[model samples]
Target: MKLDNLYIKDDTRNPTLSFKDRASAVGIAKAKELKKDVIVASSTGNAASSISGFAASAGIKNYIFVPKTAPEAKVTQLLVFGSTVFLVDGTYDEAFELCFKAAERFGWYNRSCAINPYLVEGKKTVAFEILEQLNFKVPDYVVMAVGDGCSISGAYKGFVEFYKLGLVDKIPKMIGVQSEKSNPVTRAFNKNTYEFDYIPPTTIADSISVGIPRNGIKALKAVAESGGFMIDVSDEEIIESIRILASNSGIFGEPAGVTGFAGVRKLKKLGLLKKEDIVVTVVTGSGLKDLKTAQ
Candidate 1:
C-alpha cells in the first residue's frame, strides 16, 4: 500500500472480458495449425467462455466442461457462443480431468490453460503489454491471482524472454496470490516444496478455486526464482478487495481477479512490501463475470 507507483493491468477490457482471452486466442490458432477442427477445454468460467467465443468467431467447434457451480453469466456466454457445454457435477479438478481424458480419447485439441504449452505462450503477451504500456520499464513486482498456475507462469516466462532479449534489464518479482480456501500453490511455497497434495477448494472465487493446480511446479518455480513469494487471502479479503479496487481506482474486478490486490494489502500489513517499490497487479476478469458475488 506504500508503493511509490501502483498500477493495474486491466485485462477485463479484452474481447471476452477476461485475461483468459489471451490464451484462448492462441489455442484456437494452434488448433488450426494442427488441422484440428474441434477444441476442448475445462475451466471454472473464464477460460470456457473465452475459448467458446473465439471458437465461434473462427467457425470451429468447441466443447467446454465447467463445474456446475460456475457463474451463470459465464455459462450464458458459452451458450451464446454455441459451444457444447457440459455442466460437470463436481469440482473444477474433476472437470479438468474429464476434459483431459475426453480430449485424448476423441483426438480433440485440448485448450486447457495449464496443460497446453502454447496457451501459456499466449498468456505471456500480458507481460509484454504491461512492459510496453510502462514504456518498457519493468516494475519492482508483478502480482496476479494463481489458479491452475498457467497465467503467472506465462507472465514470468514473458519477462524472462524480454530480459534475455535485453528489452528489459531485470525481471520483476512475480507475486502469486490464491484464495486461502483453494491455495495449493501458496501452501507449497510456504512449505518450501514443489510437491503439493490435492486439497479440495471451497472458495467463493470460482475462477481460482483450483484444488490441484495442474501447472503447480512451474508456478512455484516462477515465484521462487524471481525472489518473490506466494500468499493467500481469505474470501472476505477478496470481496473487500473487489470493493476497494472498484471504489478507489474505478477498476471493477471479480473476486478472483482482485485476489492479488488483496494479497498486496496483506503483504503491506505484514511489512513485506517496501515504500519505494513499484507494483503492478493484474485484474484478470471483469466484475460482470460474477455479478452475484460482486453484488
Candidate 2:
C-alpha cells in the first residue's frame, strides 16, 4: 500500500475478465484471415473462456478442452459463450495434449499459446498499451505471472518490438512470478538451468498450475535478455497478495492474476526494489473466476 511508483496493469478489465482476451482476440483475427471457421484451444479455465468468448462474437465455432478440475465459474463462462467444452479427465497438460491432437484431427485452428506463435503476437499488445498509457515512459521494472510463459514472453516481445521501432528508450527489467507448486521457470532461473523438469502441479492457483510450460525456452531467453529474473511464492503468499491487492488497490484478482503483485512484495523484501523505481505488474484475471478459493 505504501509503495511508490507502482502501477497495476489491470488486464481483468478486458471483456472476458482476463488478460487471455488480448491474445485470443489476435488469434481469432488470424483465424478469420486464414478463413478457418473452427478454432480449438485448451486451458485450466481463463484461456478457454477468453477464446470462446471472442470466437462466439466472431461467429466462429470454438472447441475448448479444460481439466475436469477447472473452476465452475469458468466452465459456466465457456458454456454460456456457446463453446463446446471438453472436461478432460486428466491434468491441464493432458487437456492441452488432447486439444493439440483434436485440432490436428479436425483441422481446426489452434489458439494455444506458445503452440500458436500468433497468440504471443496478440499478447504483446499489452506492452504497447502499457507504454502508451504511461505516455511512452518505460517503467523500471515489469512483472507478471508465468504459466506457459506466453504472457510474459509476449510482453517482452512487445518491448523488443517497440525498442526496434525507436518508440521507447529502453525496455524494463522483466520479472516473472510463479507458485512454488508450479515453479519450473523460477527454479530454472535461480539455478541458471534452462532445462525444464515437469512436476505435478499442486497449487490452488489453478490457472497457473502448469507442469510443463509450453513456452519455457522462450520465456527463459526473454528473462535472460532483459536482465530480469524469476521468483516464486507459496499459495499462502499468493492468497495474501490477492487480499492486499484488493484491500490496498481495490482491484480484485485471481491468485494467478495477482501473482505479479506477490512478486513485487518478494522483490521489496529482498531489496531488489527501490522507492523511486517505477514498476508495473499485470493483474491477469478476475477474482470472480475463482471466487470460492478467494473466500
Candidate 3:
C-alpha cells in the first residue's frame, strides 16, 4: 500500500480556496445547465463560501445563511465574493433549517448539503479524484471530517460506483470525525444504530459540529460498507493538531481540517491503525479560513 500524503484534488488549487470547489464546480455547471437563477445555501464556513464564489463565477445570484457563530473570516469571503449573506440568529443547524425553509418558500434552488442530492453527487467527485490520483489504488483507510455528511456520502458513493465500474480494486475503510459535542455520527456508530441524540454543539470543529447529522443513516453505512470506523475529538485536541500538523508536515489546517489528523492520532493511540497502513486523511479547507484557531 502506497501512502501518498500530498493532496491533489483536495489541494488548495481551486479558485475559491477550498475543497468544496469540486462540488461547487459540478453544482454551478448543473445549475447553469438547468437555468437556475437564484442559488441558496447555508454553511458554517467553507461550503456556503465555495458555492457563493462559484455562483459568482456562473453569474448566478447567491443567498447564503450562515450561523452568527461561524468565523468572521468565512463570512468575509461570502461578501467579498459578491454574494448576499445572512447572519442567522441561532446555531448552524438552525441556520440550515432557515435556509431550507427559505428554499422551499421562496422557490430558491438549495445547494445545501444532503438537502440537495445534486450537491452530494457533485461532492462525490473527491473519491473519483482520489482514485485517479492513486492510480486506481484504494487506501486502507480514508479519514475525513463530517459536517452535513454530503461530502462523506458523496465520496463513499463514488467508491461504490467506481467498484461497480471496475475502476477500483476495493473501497477503503472510511473514518469520519466529528466534534465531541456534536458527534451524532460517532455516537450512532458506537451505539450501533442511527437513533441517537448527541448534538449538544461544539467549539473546535465548527464546520462539522452538526447537531443532528442530516445523512446519519447513509453516513453510518458509508463507514460500515467501507469496513471503516468513526471517532470524535475535543476542541483542544483539534486545535493542538493544527499546530502539530503544521509543525510536522507544514500543512496548516483549520480546526475542521485538523479533525482528520485528530482521528489519525486517536486511532494511532488506540493501536487501531498500523504504521504501514496506507491512510489518506482529507484536509477539507484552508487553515486561513480560521486563522484564530490555528494561531
Candidate 2 residues 171-244, lDDT tens each?
Answer: 89998999999999988888888788888999999989999988987888888899998888889999999998
What does candidate 3's lDDT look like per residue over 1-295, in tens digits?
Answer: 2233423234445676677887788778878888989999888888888998899877999899998988888999999889999999988889889999999999888887677767777767888888888888788888888876776777899889999998877888888888776788888899898786854686667888778777778888898888887888788889888888778777777788778778788878878776677777788877888988776
Model 2 residue pairs with clashes: none
lDDT, candidate 1, at 115: 76
Model 1 per-residue lDDT tens digits across residues 234-286: 99999999999999999999999899899889988899888887899999999
- Candidate 1 ranges beyond 4 A from true positions: none
Q: Each prediction's TM-score against the native? A: 0.98, 0.98, 0.94
Poorest stretch of ten by lDDT in candidate 1 = 1-10
TM-score of 3: 0.94
lDDT of each: 0.93, 0.93, 0.81
